[model samples]
Target: MSSLTHTTTPANTPVERKATRSAGRRTSPNALLSKGVVNALLIVAAFYTLMPVSWLLFAATKSDRDLFSTSGFALGDFNLFANLHHVFTFNDGIYLRWFGNSILYSVVGSAASTFLCIATGYAFDTYDFKGKEKLFAAVLGGVLVPTTVIQLPMYLLATKVGIVNTYWALLLPALVNPFGVYLARVFSEGYVPNEVLEAARVDGAGELRIFAGISLPMLAPGFMTIFLFSFTASWNNFFGALVMLNDEKLYPVNLGLFMWNSVTQQQPEYYSLVITGSLVAVVPLIVAFVCLQRFWRSGLTAGAVK
Candidate 1:
């Protein structure tokens, strides 16, 4: 009665604690709305990205009449096999020749380009030279320049060298990929540690041996990445092939397809062949990426880790 009994009360009761947790667990309306919007945008982006490819897949399966009359995305009379037969047998199987040439240019040109880039990049990274930085800066400048700007000049040079309209015209120009060199240099810096090279040197290993046995393994991923990039670029090099080559026998698939597509306006029968040829032309690229994606991923990861 005289004084208040000194008593302590809990800051929060069980009911209040439960209510607090419920409030904490509940997501705000704005957050849910934002999440839904993000998901919707991604769905729309995916559909937009894939729509053309889907249309191409369906179009390649249709006959000329069906290609024009039927819905662009709908399945037609299942003429893919028939169209492929035509693509292979048409014009004395010229498509096959073009396909072979495409493979030749892509494989040989990309392989050689990748090797040269590796060696050059490794040299720049490992060895001290008088004007290394300046040379590399020049290469970077080349990367910024557009290929189209130099196509005419390259053609003129090819003509002067008497390699115009030849396979060398196509292959030689492709071997000098500035971007590939830049990428390889970056990869070498990350993957090839100096200590390892020094150890090898001390242990009686020559530069070539150290590079071939040790450095090359670590740089495998980089090599694969460069090869894939060069291959794709060479395969799709339409303008360069157009300007440098006139011989139908040396034409890559891109120029060959462009030639077919140009005539499709007057010769409507070439429509299915063109579509089918394009579909076939891209299969190898798809296969290549699928096969080498693991190596590419590893290479990227190695760079990140290093």
Candidate 2:
């Protein structure tokens, strides 16, 4: 039995054992350290991003005196209702008009933009036409051009067409989103199948009918994504409205808030109203993202698969 045990243990000398130990220590320690560092960094980033939003929530509940005196992160007296009342009831309820205008512009303009983008994208993806590539390239180039840079030209065009102070000025520009077109085209190339289109064609389906019935359903999520993007962009648009609108009645919520902020310098009481208005303006964006987040995720995955 002692001879058999000795023969069985005749392997794994000191050098072999040392080498195995060395490899285990080298690989395991480095991998664990890397994972730990990554987790720490992610936590830090999340905290940094959320801190300001947290501050805003607390700040909105405070009065003007408390806003300046109290620590920004601390909860103040709950004056949210009073502040909202002032925000809505002030200036003969001009804020409500601005709110209504913003909603109208965002809903109408974003919907139009999404439809146009989907149609343009579908055409680019499915059809072989002359100048199609050039057209798409031009659209992408337009996306690279900042909206601020074209503000003067857009203003000039609006003035020439006598649409300058009207809803048309805002809605027209919002409808022509280059990024939405690009996103739609990319999504269509993947989410929409050539075989499905061919089958629809073989079934004597008209182009408009196939597009309305077949393509639109597949593009629904993409449309919603573009709509959200357009809505946010239109909602937050300050410079465009600032430049285009002279009539306070026509102002969107962003510009109206800016006006309120400006007047707060002269009339300090406007501060609480401005804060409340800002809080109200932000709610729609939050609601939109929450409602459509699932669709956005699915759309992204579908696009990636193609």
User: Which candidate leads in TM-score?
Assistant: 2
Give the poorly placed runs of model 1, Cα more than 4 Å off.
Answer: 1-42
| Backbone clash count for every predicted candidate, in the order shown | 0, 0
TM-score of each model, in listed order:
0.87, 0.88
**Tens digits of lDDT, candidate 1, 38-96:** 99999999999778778879998898899999898899999989999999999899999
What residue pairs clash in candidate 1, if any at all? none
Tell me the spans in candidate 2 whose CA falls farther than 4 Å from its real position.
1-27
- Model 2 gets an lDDT of 0.89
Given candidate 2, what's the lDDT at residue 273? Answer: 83
Where does the lowest 10-residue lDDT sum fall in candidate 1?
A: 297-306
